[model samples]
Target chain A: MTAWITYVVTAAGLTLVALIRPFLGRQNELFGVVFGTRNIRQDQVGRSLKQQYLIETLSLAVLVWGGLALMAWWHQQPPYLALGMIAFLLAALAATANAHRLSSQYHQQLAVPEAMRVSVDLTQLANEQTLSPVWGMVLLPLVGVGFALPWSAVAWANLTVGLVVGGTFLLTRHLAANVHGLAAAPGAAQARNILLSFLLAVAVVAQGFGLACAWQPAQAGLFSLVFGLLTLLGLLLLLITWLQVTRRQAPAGAVRTDNARWYWGVFYYAPNDSSLFVTKRIGVGLTLNYAHPASWFLLLGVVAVVATIAVLSN
Target chain B: MELTVDFASTVPIYTQIRNAVIQAIADGRLKSSEVLPSVRALGSALGVNYHTVNKAYTQLADEGFITMRRGLGAMVAEQLPAVDPHFEAEVVPQMKALFTEAKVRTVDRQTLVALIDQVYDEGWHH
Candidate 1:
């Protein structure tokens, strides 16, 4: 009964993720947050989004059904659960890459209008404060200690994951300081606040997981349930914040320009742009300028790091 | 003081930044002895290379518009430098070009004069 319940729960979670996949990294209509190709119509965006959803659903179904078949054939001798997870992660990465490529192609097809060709005054962004160095002192010590502590493998893994979550929160704060140049603008500030809140919630949940793993491994099932609930809470908070930001009316003199050109909705390229980093058009994050040589180096470095992580994890 | 640079303009970015700062000073938007944001801070905020902002700051410092002090960042000068002899010669042509464009566009002399007066009055009052 417990095994059957686990299967059902896992399937439900995968389905939910597949459904939500289309919405992730999508541009908000009102805020102009992500890849700002105003020329791309909503219908076109919806069509591509739907296509991405279908691909994700198909990939997930293959992972679930194929894994089940293999497990049944082999009588679960080969640890089917781990294989399934690996397959799911690979599928997710592929889907993301595909979606980005498609978005960029759509952007390339759109006509650049004369009105959208405007210059932005970056001076307005100068008033906003950067991430405090104190956050570094707070987060890095925990990560370092987690690595140094003599703990069981599972406990250490949990702690490491918590540290990574905390690290990501700090990194996001740093990136947010640099990307959202117009700090005084209502939309920009609200977006930053929402993003910070979401990261904080996720970090807290990760820390809870780490603590549970360290103190109560025998109650793993209970801990998993708690983790799920906390993660859901974090997701809910993010959703609510996103809605608030997207729905809020833009303030007067908000920075608007068509300086950024997308290569495939994934890579940003602007020949005239002096900065290497630009605010993503589709999501609340920063992206690189493909036109810049340093950006290419950065991309290569990221790819190498991700590959290393994947190999090590496997 | 509010400063803006148009990334899309044919004019160099550093020059635009320098002009904006000078304009702000002339318009009294930036008061004497007011501290400006550090080059690194401004560069990060503007999403530009630090060198670009540094170039602008250096030019401003050379022109006696602002003073760059170690550890203190840039500060607006207490008294601006006297206008150079070539200042009028350089400015008149630019002003004439604008007037010529306005004339070609059929803007009346009275309207142009009124516009100039309004701009001058706003800057003085501000």
Candidate 2:
């Protein structure tokens, strides 16, 4: 099979999974990282389960189709692989944005009763998980070895990307250490830190493979095998974590406001709320409070950056 | 320590935060010299602006209920400040107004005393 066929298959499979996710489990239990809402009360959200499913399915279908079309058009030209990648990336982003918009609409329609609204304790929310700086120091030698090996432009570019991505994970660890209240929820904090470390390790190893590929292009088959295996393993790890999070019960006294004041049960917008980001009442992630002006600026900034990256990468 | 703010309440968000910390301290959930969450972290967790948390922390610091260090964040004060000499003067009028309203509502002196005793027993500060 051509490389483009593999990309098309993967994209289609993932979209199909997303479309069928709601039916596979309890409504509240199905947490979509990018496209799904948290445990919003169905009655209050004003959207039937079928409606949400339809919305996600249609958006994802469009995404997959767009990606497939791009792959098909660029398939004959190996030099256009970068353009294909950019097209797929943009399609994915659009799908996510569409999902967010639909989710926000549902949230805006919610009618939360006063009694169910609860407040979060800042102290308890403080994150205390930390990773030692020594871990980064230990990886410096691998980076040195990678640099010492002979390199090509593409190999150097891949290595640079890997290092940058790996460095982000390390930076996240450092930032997480300073965040208060993370320690209060040690399980989540520790899991997040471990995931970051795992990603960092994977990036470093991937850099080594880039070096190998640069040195001996004939061994590309072996590298692809290893890459495929790693991808599968990463997906497995993600699935395990997602299950653990969704299965875990909400803590006692968690605010279960049925209100759609949170745009789409994801982007929160309570004018009185002074926080820029709040822990999700129904899910494992943090949501930006749209009521805060800075939240909009931040969201816009993120979109701009991603759009720029997609363009430049193409 | 548990903290909550009612967005619909007339109470200011900063005051709610400040009062919650004070209540935690009184309930012994937050101990003397215990480090409190950083303003930014708490703000992010609660979905409030960091400045709102900073305001609460600053107010607590001003009241000598907590101390703020540059890198260490805020910590509960080892010794809470003594009540101001004018505290009684400031409180008595409010207390009298409350009692007058209770009396007008036909609440007996005994019931008022009982309520006060219960709240006092619950402990705001040691």
Highest TM-score model number: 2
Across B1-126, the per-residue lDDT of candidate 2 in tens digits comes to: 667666668888899888888888888888898888877556655545678989999999988899999977789999997888555776899999999999899999899999999989878654
Q: Over the stretch A222-285, how does candidate 2's per-residue lDDT look in tens digits?
A: 9978977886687567546754643343323333333445443334567755555444433333
Candidate 2 stretches with Cα past 4 Å from truth are A1-4, A20-111, A114-141, A146-191, A248-251, A256-314, B84-126
**Taking the tens digit of each residue's C-alpha lDDT, what string does model 1 give over B6-105?**
6568988788889878888887777788778777656645556678889999999988899999977788899888878667777899999999999899
lDDT of 1 by residue, A1-314 (tens): 56545655665666566455445432322112233333233566646655665667676667665676467557844335545556665665466556656554554555323232222333333344545435434434434545565555534554555555455454444242222224223455456556656655566566556656656779978888888888888777776676466434332333333434553244566664456655454444556668879778766866775686579769
**TM-score of chain A for candidate 2?**
0.59
Highest-scoring model, DockQ: 2
Question: Could you tell me the TM-score of chain A in candidate 1?
Answer: 0.60
- Hey, what RMSD does candidate 2 come out at? 6.7
In terms of docking quality, model 2 is acceptable
Evaluate fnat for each of the predicted models and list the values in order. 0.20, 0.51
Give the CA lDDT, 0 to 100, for residue A207 in model 2.
66
